[model samples]
Target chain A: MSLADLTIAEAGKQLRSGQATSVDLLEAVIERASFTEAQLHCYLTIDHEGARKAAESADRELAAGTDRGPLHGIPLALKDNFCTRGMTTTCSSQILAGYVPPYDATVVSRLRSGGAVIVGKTNLDEFAMGSSTENSAFGPTRNPWDPERVPGGSSGGSAAAVAVGSALGGFGSDTGGSIRQPASLCGVVGFKPTYGLVSRYGLVAFASSLDQIGPLARNVGDALTLFEAVAGHDPLDSTSYPGPVPEMRSDLEAGPKGIRVGVVTELSGEGYEPAVSTAMAEMLNRLAADGAELVEVSLPTFELALSCYYLIAPAEASANLARFDGVRYGLRVDGETVEEMMARTRAEGFGPEVIRRILLGTYSLSAGYYDAFYGQANRLRTKLIREIAEVHERVDVLVSPTSPTVAFELGAKTQDPLAMYLSDVCTIPADLAGTPAISVPVGLDHQGLPIGLQVMAPALGEAVMFRMARAVEERAGFTARPAMAGLPT
Target chain B: MPIEIDIAHVARLARLALTPDELDRYRSQLAVILDHAARVQAVDTTGLAPTAHPLGLSNVFRPDEVRPPLDVDEVLSQAPSARDGYFEVPPALEGA
Candidate 1:
């Protein structure tokens, strides 16, 4: 088998057995990237020389008995939003024209320490504001399943890179459904850990309260390994969870024999495409057949999750993004005065969708509208969190389709912003309540596009979440690879 | 009450100088979004505290200790325009 086909665990075994070197894994992914990148556009930058040097060092170290565990010498991609020292970190927006950080984000530091090879930075929606990566200033990342369809965003590029086999896994930040939605559409596994479980120090802030970084991988185990590498407390991030990171590797192989899988009643029927619903039903049946007890549970306030998210996230974004004026780093447009320069720079730097969201945030937080808009949304968030917690008291985890439909054609919903936002319905509840959730490929729809089943767990409930996800992964037997992967296997 | 979205005013508050066409386009689009968002207004969340974050945790503080800061030259090098170790900008006091 080609080196690119190996999962992280399998690759680690190869490295340990002296059968394959780190350079061999890096070379395979680099070669795969050369063939697929032109068609996929998954990376903003691919550091050919830097990655080679890192892989060589990892190989040398391993020879000297300095193995850094599973991630050592493993090739991976990062979402552009994460700051990397001396590397361009644009968040895929023009506003950050040619800006490179002098310091690495805490997570980037973790990955580098873990001995992972950084292949390149992946693309996302400008400031991660849009569901479709079409909002990226550079351009949209095409779905590897079909070049015509969007690879779901704002982490589309990372998901597409993993789906196309150019990278074994890629790390992307999940705010709302950014990581999970794209993973679903691209036929891969995406996990969004419980908020605060991962530090946010170097992730470009977009709605600070909601953003959490996680991994997109070819399978559930690889995703968990990637998550384990970066999940921990950091003094740099004030919100980083102080509790010990829950141990999950031991429980991954366990079956969900008596796990109460909550089938979210509100997430069922209506709005979902018939094909998607059919795939979801089949996945549920497979889980039931595998010994998981499925129970019907309702989160009534889930209907308001989208609206609440729109208000709360953008309000925080307007405040967080205000730092990108003309005076600081990034794009600058001179004017007669500093105030004029700041206004003109922002107008030119931010895109239409970004500008719209910023304005919405401003209007919502403006005097007289605060109580009616931002205040009301924040309260709704509290209610949503409470409902999710209450339901989890009975069920170990919640199950739903990752997205309402499979990958849709690019430009399908870009015109109507609301239509684009509606795509994240199934994934938003977990984000609102700050719980752990994952999207695992279950089966494919009639169009042959992959369908994802999302499993959500209460805060810090990694053990149960991984158990159910592994159960789904084993039961689904979803072996259909994207024809566009086009790898020489 | 349906909001009369003043796109221009909101843009000014947001420090974005939108063109007239963008202003017109966003006015209608944002109205539709806000109209949908009005659902939250109908429900009275009496006494429910706003969730600043889902973890029910407040802000954290680092130890108040003196430490070396980033290099001044390196920080200044990234500014749009800097002069003699100071960031250069247009007139800040407007008329002055």
Candidate 2:
């Protein structure tokens, strides 16, 4: 069995039938994680001993006839941003390097409850601020398909882990396309649910309103399974929704026969590489062939999304991260006095990109500039929300390129921060609108790298996104493992 | 539509004591960044209220309830130095 072909759902089936023991399955996953870690630099830490103990317990549970449903005995990875009690949830930053949380993030608790064994915590950009994992203190995570290129980030490590079969599925947090961009570059399916669908209680705050925890997996089915496990209201996070959670897997069975799929006109051309454009167009053709109506919808304000995002996200981050001052927790820097200590601590703890964000955010939210910058950005955000709402009335799902192109070589655009930020252009609109979007592997480019097709559903419509994404995955049907393919031993 | 990106000012704000070479490099980069940012000014947003959230969920209030914190000593053990019940650090002010 090419374990790569087995989604988490299929893996669960095998585990339930006594076809594979959790320890045996986890050993395979751990080995893959280690192998990929060495080449792709995907992990900041690997917890084999803990994972083995968890796996052993899972076996005990199965022996006791107490299965935790589809996720029982499944191996999963978590982005470093999600706090896993007793594990260093560093967010790949020196600021929180030695910090280990005393309690699990709501998502971590949910995943554990569902019987998923966490193999390790993956690397990411510091504080989930940058589009490239290059900002990570540990080091950049390489794209699994080509070691020379980046895995789209800040969820790069999570995406790379899933892409290389290091884990059956994993969790990632998205702020301005962090999850979807990496998923696209790594050629896996990544979903970012509606903002409030998944509790953000333990997710290390980035842009508070923008950050959301979601799933990255081999296929849409696995994505749905993982999503269902981690999503729902949490008493700890008031932003979490108490509304209806869709039966995503069943919705997939109902399929895309009459769904209205819109091709977002603004996301189509200018910055997109030919391969990305071709991949998206091909998916549109496939959806049309499956009897789904495809229409061209306009998001006129989308051109301003990146601008508004930069201002608003940073403005909020500046406030949220203020609690990290030396007094509270995490890293502390000593100085002659408390004021100096605070200054020294912040100066020494944060990376250049993080400091840049805090300053920019502080400036934007400053009293005199508030109306000119933050206030104006919020207004533009409202218009964006209204436009997206109107468009959804005409379409069941929206289609776009997840990224402008395949992963670029390391250091290629790092020096040009502006160019680097543009990599997220295609994926940012959905984040601004608080919609659910997923990136599914569509095809490969000439050099044999994977491309992704982004499918977006309106607020709380993750099921529709999954149905459409699965349709594209089914039709395009491209399955090439990362260059360093991890076939079972 | 030209905005001067002063590297010295930026360096001071970031608390980085930049060398001459570092200042020049950052100056060139910031110039390009601001030029790109100027695109926002050209946008006609006369009547639009700036958006703070795309999802429209506002007034997200959690129940005010006290929860157990991590072991204080264990959490504080992570600090570089500590004394008594407070974190021990260099004093707040220094006569420079």
Best by TM-score: 1
* Local accuracy of candidate 1 as per-residue lDDT tens digits, A292-351: 789999888998888888888888899999999977689999899888899999999998
Candidates' chain A TM-scores: 0.98, 0.97
In order, the interface RMSDs are 1.0, 3.1
After superposition, the stretches of candidate 2 with alpha carbons farther than 4 Å from their true spots are A2-5, A485-489, B4-31, B44-48, B64-66, B93-96
lDDT of 2 by residue, A1-489 (tens): 545346887788788888887887788777676566777877888887888888999999998999998888888889999988888888888778878887899999988888889988998999998777989988899888888899989999999989888788888999899999999889899999998889999899988878899999988888888888988888788777767786676678665689998888998787788988987787778777879998999998888888878878878888887767667567777766676567667777888777767766765676576776777777777888888999998999988889988888998987777788899998888888889999988989998888888888888887788888888888878677776754343
Candidate 1 clashes between residue pairs 3 or more apart in a chain or in different chains:
none
Docking class of 2: acceptable
Residue A88 in candidate 2, Cα distance off native in Å: 0.9
RMSD of model 1 against the true structure = 1.2
Residue A485 displacement (Å), model 2: 7.2
Give lDDT per model, in order: 0.89, 0.81
The candidate scoring highest on DockQ is 1
